[model samples]
Target: MADGASGLGDQARAEAYALPLEDLNPGDPELFRTDTHWPYFERLRAEAPVHWCKESEFGSYWSVTRYNDIMSVDTNHQVFSSGAALGGITIRDARPDLRRPSFIAMDPPKHDVQRKTVSPIVAPANLAVMEPIIRERAGRILDELPVGEVFNWVDRVSIELTTQMLATLFDFPFEERRRLTHWSDVATCLPMPGALCETEDARQAELMECLAVFTDLWNQRVNKPPAGDLVSMMAHSDATRDMTPDEYLGNIILLIVGGNDTTRNSISGGLYALNKFPAEYDKLRANPGLIPNMVPEIIRWQTPLAHMRRTALVDTEIAGQPIAKGDKVVMWYVSGNRDEAVIENPEAFRIDRERPRQHLSFGFGIHRCVGNRLAELQLKIVWEEILKRFRHIEVVAEPKRVRSSFVKGYEELPVVIHA
Candidate 1:
């Protein structure tokens, strides 16, 4: 079933998307910058949950803003395949062969096997072993925040904790943790036009450099005997039988990028939300048990990753909107988080609000984020540590958002810490 309205011509679709009160110019590439999502997503979700967008740099695509529509696309992976385009998931049309293929972009049976291989490591049983270590690290990170002084939380604390934990999972050498973190940042920030490098050639080189570093790391891990870690689990698992070395390298990059960035974003984003809503902050501080409820509220308020694009495999209609096969349909999680129908007073950030975690920040369906529980765990423990140490935390400077639209939360978040 195609959407009721046939696919409009480029001009008409663009005109339809030209709404008032939008800070973004959908006609420009910045509207779909790979680093950040708020400006464009805020506009689209407010104006058109199912609107069309086109930029000279990235071409045309349909943006799904409604919660139900986004959920439909996310759930119906068959009708809306992750494997549609040759390039990877971002809206920017990546060069087909140059883009690394991860299970994140694979469809069906292949995705199933790959996901299964790594799922056990993140299962409740294994993650239980990590809880104490994670709690200790969280305490150290928060406790070390300069008392009665201002510090940049994003770089100094948030990213450090997330990537360090990921390093532990891979058993990466301590000195190499920062490099792996840098690689994840580069891979996710690819669609940003000049965030890292000026030219496409330079961008491709940087990407390959990250891939090569990851490949070297994976080969070393494979050569060694099995260990009780994610790398060893994947290497020894029967589920990965047909997986080639390249695919392992690709998926390793995927897991690192996925695991590191999103959790880092959640931590920093949670800080932002608390600062944004002092009442909510007060609530959490007064009743630390509210931390559980606050976790979802923070995710909802942050809506960190924004939108993920899925290509229509077969023609389909969603919410009376017709989507053609191969058409790129983007589900705007940021908008879905603010959906009025699903969330009462969606704009309000209330920690005590029931079901605060209902926002589609982790997405839905088969491709829903796998490290979601871990990310939530990190947020919980980090906040617990923060509350135990600091009586008051306030933003000292305006936060800096990433330049790209893909993996977004914060680049610089300076905060004044009070004991």
Candidate 2:
């Protein structure tokens, strides 16, 4: 467990320590919301790296907690399918009634073709084009921060910047950019009070609105010359151009959620992590050049999206644990990022770690995050711009974490920026 786990309530810590290893259910959303899930995952990694929970809110699922075990499952996508027809790439099974099919939840050949269609948007060439724009936005965001006053960094800085970048990617209307964030939230949120929606029906209706809006964009772009934007790329590519309405909507949700959550949360998480480890923040202040290397470390520490699930296509064993066909196998990237066997001093936040990118925050195999380089590029530029302007960004209160085991991120982070 990270040293920060010590900050958990004494009774909670005692309970975590006393609980039987088999009784440790790491999927509990309350643990994540309270930011006290570390001890549960710590116990899991120590006792049963490949453990099964007979039942839970999502249903029975197997958790692969350690680093190598997660790698084995993540790399072997053939054995552990990501198909929506099977169950999709989340612990929760896809609804048979409301099936939204996207490439990430697809098996290869089809997955490969569709993934290739949008690959160029985040390619090295496109990221190079995007760098200046990202830096400019980062600078403006930082410059506008209220000096020595409390503000929600998650909303003002993280969401705003990432949403702007998402707008640029899809050539979305700047005025209605918040809708992208709303749809992204609604897609992943578990439909609770204070969440994006309060019911499954509400989630679906908002997503349908998202589909309608994007469908208009698709119609407009499909008739024009091919351009560099993501919508344009999808409209022009033979592999993706002919997608059905549901498939198109699914892909849009996938791209929007992918574009919004990871980077936005990491932006917020990086600051929070630095504040939690003041020494690391001091190291960053002293040597700003570490920004490039530190970005991946932040991603590793944050492990933005906690886990990705795969349904077993056939009987398989992960680390000696037999997984029956159709069983849900969740590769807990959150745990793997902290596995002591793979990461040296996994608890501490160090800016100058060797092999910083050697983390599973991005999954392995063909389904590795397509926008990874773009994400890293955004973080690097933001940190660089922040260093130039601010002397320190202090976390004034505990962040209000999103109440979902899946999207491990902040809903709000109160901070005071010092120039």
Candidate 3:
């Protein structure tokens, strides 16, 4: 639901403002599902940058809402741990027996080493190598679209491009590439009675199948020489080679979600945001060179993957608010991205900002997104290709957003291309 809807956004805004600061639960997935989470975050940022929620669906947690405060919390990894033992990165805590440790979810030493193993995939040389491939693939995807007919942009372009690239990264089977998308969604989704995933047990069942499939891939790759693909890299590298079965699955989920959701949603969000702010679209069409800047601006505007949660390793005070030991501290990147103190006109989707990249979307410090540059490159290439073929991509309807507050993304965006 877009803001300023007759009842939804205005009602949410009123409730958000009227609620006692301590009672506000911005992490509620329902708010995000309806796109009404904005005003709640806005209230927290303005009134309680370091607010405490005594209760939530996840549990009691501390919210660090401002830009600098989030930076402080994110960078100070020693004080705030991302260990799977404490709880993984998102607001949702996994069951004790199911806690799987990925590089992004581990503390230093192990986290550093495993992250380094796959870092080469997105290095400048690798990105340079992949640019032409991305551009060519993006062109083909766009070229095939019907000019006058409406289609779901999320499935047609966003999912197709990100999944294709993710398949290439993992050297996954081309025909079953959509499984990557499915697994990514399943990994971040909340298990509710009426939801896509009915229960935790059902979710685990699907994930086990993912592990089994990847296990086959791993077994096939282990005896071979070291290769460029992620599976081969993990199979060969000392840092990742001896990982436990659960650790292996954790890293696989991280890679799939990292490589799939962020870029995929941003691709859809860019078109949708531009459509929201038509002048920005006009500016982009007049000067396509603004794309490099526009890409990050869209990332900032979208703030895909809204928040990253960390468990307090020790007693710490964030912005003068005391956070006890073992407390969950959630850095609201979606809120921070809109912190007026840092970003001028934080709400507007402007393509030409003096410093468009100066926002906290991919995150900060040691745990920052490893594939951020790749995400930017994918978005840049798609838009570059899009501007070449289509005069406009008109939003046929309001996009269906993913329900989870963590993975801020689109489920579907209906649109018609004007060529």
Candidate 4:
């Protein structure tokens, strides 16, 4: 660990963190609002390390900003419970109490059982079998891009690519795949202003609409014979130990949101990064094998999903700060990845950095992202296809970022592809 203060030792730093959480404000723009996490975490990482702030809307909560502290909380599941907090994993609770719960919000042993149902479907081996399909779809999508013309890359490529892949995974009717996309959009895109309407009634209505579509799919999968795809795998995989229809629906919703949101974000974000740094793009084009290293660097730079919240189950101390029982503590992965204590010159994006893959975008410990390898695979293949097909890709318009803070994704990316 890079010492927070190189001039001092661990003992002095731990002593500073013993200060009260009330001294720091976690509800600031960087911490409270989801628009961006870096500014708030950077300050916390440097200042309080473990601090708390009160929010006008949500209650007061502790913010764990340092890399070591975030990793400590993430790995110590016994001390910090993922399920104890409201709405579970994410800090914001935009969904109505009656709304469905995804696996991200649930803690074991239910989380364990539900994850196992479809875990095999996304396992590395399964993804190896899935590579050709993803690559083929990726090729088809890239081939359709308007050469020598400007188009919105987010819709034309990123979103469509992930959505189509997901449709094939669930065996949904091609045209109807947009329905799955819509459900995921509303479910994860909540909390942002205009995401769900300002009114609770309006938000509930949107959620109900999303739920209706998922319910239809669940029934369809249940009634049909085994098809060897994900839906069938979830339906018949050890029913005695598997999720109930409700639980299955929730977990499926989780998978859709996880798969669509992050993968699409990486696609769009990587393009934006490459466009912003033409030198990096040139470097990548010169040596295509750099795609593997570049993929992790992109994930680290984008940090698609921001901080994940965990509640301290029993009173515990992280990096010497005492966390009370039931206190809401966030593992600010966004800050950790950029921590000066860990990554050297953390802010700059270097494609050929000796250790570009050291960051924690997929997370750490037992709850690390299950589809991590698949995400990386998609990134590498997408870049490979783009490099082969196009001589240059430039961003023609400022990319519109998603309103939600939880998912730092590009909502629209206008690009001109010159083949």
Candidate 5:
């Protein structure tokens, strides 16, 4: 059932079309885990780009399916709020006692200043400086991989590479960098019986541990001269230096997940997309110069971190569908990225598109991903290094995808390298 860019079989596709429009609930995490959410989104974009669901496990919400409608909702933050107090930015509402404030979940002046503190880490000059370092590390990781034996690419390359980069940015303990990955997974994964943490209390306990470890690092850097790391940047900045413990943990989880999950999943997703569309893989192999363009296209095809939610602060209408005050509006970026009306031949994964960055993966508006440039740089360098070393990194099996709808990523990707 694990698939990306694979055909939804006839029966599955029919089931999606056969559903009563009222029964469509794209927010279901099971649909994502099995990679069968495409047909439902396809139906929505065609039939009701701004559809209403009277009920769902996450409670009733409006789904904005097309590209322009999503843009309208994402950019007009005044009408659509992301305040943590207003239930934050995801479909799942955090328990009242558990919600914490982070810039992505805040609006206006506070969001502006706090975001500025972390923005410099991904600035052009900084990205240029980090490029060679990323390239060198990427080479080392690829060089270490076994050629003939199958291994989980998600663990071996994707996670290791992104975790190393996260450590570099945070100046986190070298050997303990994997802890960042664990914290990120715990932050986003649903607390179901088989998931990372089975209870919200257990999840909170682990997050507290994360806060404790980062608090120690904060102490170390608070008194020292300001340095280049994210930890130091926040410790020195007025906007975030005095954040409450809960607020600090909120931002930490945001940064860890933002910096780790998105890029690592894209790293894994890009490889999976290419393997799924072998013609594109051949195109990449034929023209290594295309890596620059291919990076963004791969991101478009994957659309990691599927949907970002917002709460309507006032009455609004998207695609003529009425949304009242306090309504939860979920922008389906996964669907928008594939809207045929927006991109030419979106269903086809081509490496050399003329306008590869036009997709909505990084989103549009004030809350657009802060570390987006860093992500692109990481992917570009990784692919560049990959093309130099191997003809193909064959996906020997369908990826074992993560269970949550929030984090559209792989838990495992079995693969073997061919020289």
Candidate 6:
């Protein structure tokens, strides 16, 4: 029985390695949903760093798989544009009729101006101010966990903490904070049965409701004195104060997803990964001081946002692959984080790595995540508090992953705490 099982495993591994590059579509939602994307990306990184997919659910797009190649494309925003008008920033081209314009989707002066308007919300000083609140909430959530009983950590811990933080950032109504999670999920999820929304129209309708709710907040903020929250800052800032309704909605979606999904998923992913590598969890337990270092390592391993898509502004060649003007280019940050060339034992999840933050989880250059420092701060505090409270938070089963290529995250993680 053991030999037969070993042979089956060997066959699976061999088939994964033998998957034709032409057949390797890394953007498939099913691959991510089933957590079978690693082998496909590993195969691409090894063989075709800058691979072109002739067809996909999102249509033809070029995949930039290597670490350095992704950096080159990411940093050189001039040649590769992130403009919303040019299909926005996803493998799925923005619908001409349903164009949503946000600053992250803009290039040059506009992107910088609008980004600066909200940057202070996550500025170092502000993060210090927010740290205690985050820690307090994390502690409360951990304290509330049902001892020795199976529970969904994704909902109880990850979503609860991140939703609270998102509410704090927007100064949003605490009771309605789960709305933000719904909106974020709606914005990123594919239109499929059992997903967040089964139709594009349904997704847009929910997002429109999101816009209406935030618009009320925007109005209230604009009429009042400037405050530290993201909505207030945007209302008061010259660059974003006069944004079009669509632009405002787009930015709101960006911030909601940025604030919620990345951190929430990482919180869940970190525990899942540690459980996968128990020795690393033992190392973490042996030295709680490694929490800060381990935070980035977890982010690197989880790669909360799988890929950031850009449009080729001019005909350009990336790693010798010719990319034409107006072509969709996807920088697979997930693959780059695992690229063996840049990271030693890239597949291993080591908390004490020499350079934990060296990976591409938070893309480089001007568009690097503004909330990255804040994200790290929250994760670090959560883990620190977790260590003080529990001996082990055991993952009872494989996590139910979100069925989307963009927002790589968990839908559920069954866990039990052992004190």
Best by TM-score: 3
lDDT of 6 by residue, 28-54 (tens): 987788777777778788888999888
Overall lDDT per candidate, in order of appearance: 0.73, 0.90, 0.93, 0.72, 0.91, 0.90
Ranked candidates, highest lDDT first: 3, 5, 2, 6, 1, 4
In order of appearance, the predictions have TM-scores of 0.88, 0.97, 0.98, 0.87, 0.98, 0.96
| Cα lDDT tens digits for candidate 4, 186-225 | 7655444555466666655776676566567656777777
Model 5 residue 355 distance off true place after TM-score fit, in angstroms: 1.3
Lowest-scoring 10 consecutive residues by lDDT in candidate 2? 1-10
lDDT by residue (1-419, candidate 3, tens digit) is: 24344488788899999988989999999888899998998988889999889899899998899999999999998999999999989898999999999999999999999999999999999999999999999999998898889899999999999999999999999999999999999899899898778999999999999999999999999999988999999999999999999999999999999999899989999999998888999999999999999999999999999999999988979988889999999999999999999999999999999999899999999989999999999999999899888888899788899999999999899899876
For model 6, the run of ten residues with the poorest summed lDDT: 1-10
What's the residue-level lDDT of 337 in candidate 2? 96
* Superior candidate under TM-score, 3 versus 6: 3
lDDT of 5 by residue, 11-51 (tens): 55888999999998999998898888888999999998998
* Residue clash pairs of candidate 6: none
Candidate 1, residue 235: how far the Cα is off, in Å:
2.0
Q: Could you tell me how far off, in angstroms, the CA of residue 318 lies in candidate 1 after the best superposition? A: 1.9
What is the TM-score (0 to 1) of candidate 6? 0.96
Q: Candidate 1 vs candidate 6: which has greater lDDT?
A: 6
- Model 3 regions lying over 4 Å from their true place: 1-7
- Per-residue lDDT tens digits for candidate 2, residues 1-419, read 02444557665767888977667778878888988888777878988889888878888899999999999999998899999888799877767977778999999989999999998899888888899999999999888889989999999999999999999999999999999999988898887776668888888999899999999999999999999988999999999998988899999999998998999999999999999989999999999999999999999999999999999999989988889999999999999999999999998888899999999998999999999999999999999998888888899888889988889999999999866
Q: Measured by TM-score, how close is model 3 to the native structure?
A: 0.98
**Candidate numbers sorted by TM-score from highest down:** 3, 5, 2, 6, 1, 4
- Residues 29-146 of candidate 1: C-alpha lDDT, one tens digit per residue: 3333332233445556666567765543566678787788789889987787776245456666667765556788888898898898888767898789889999998887776678
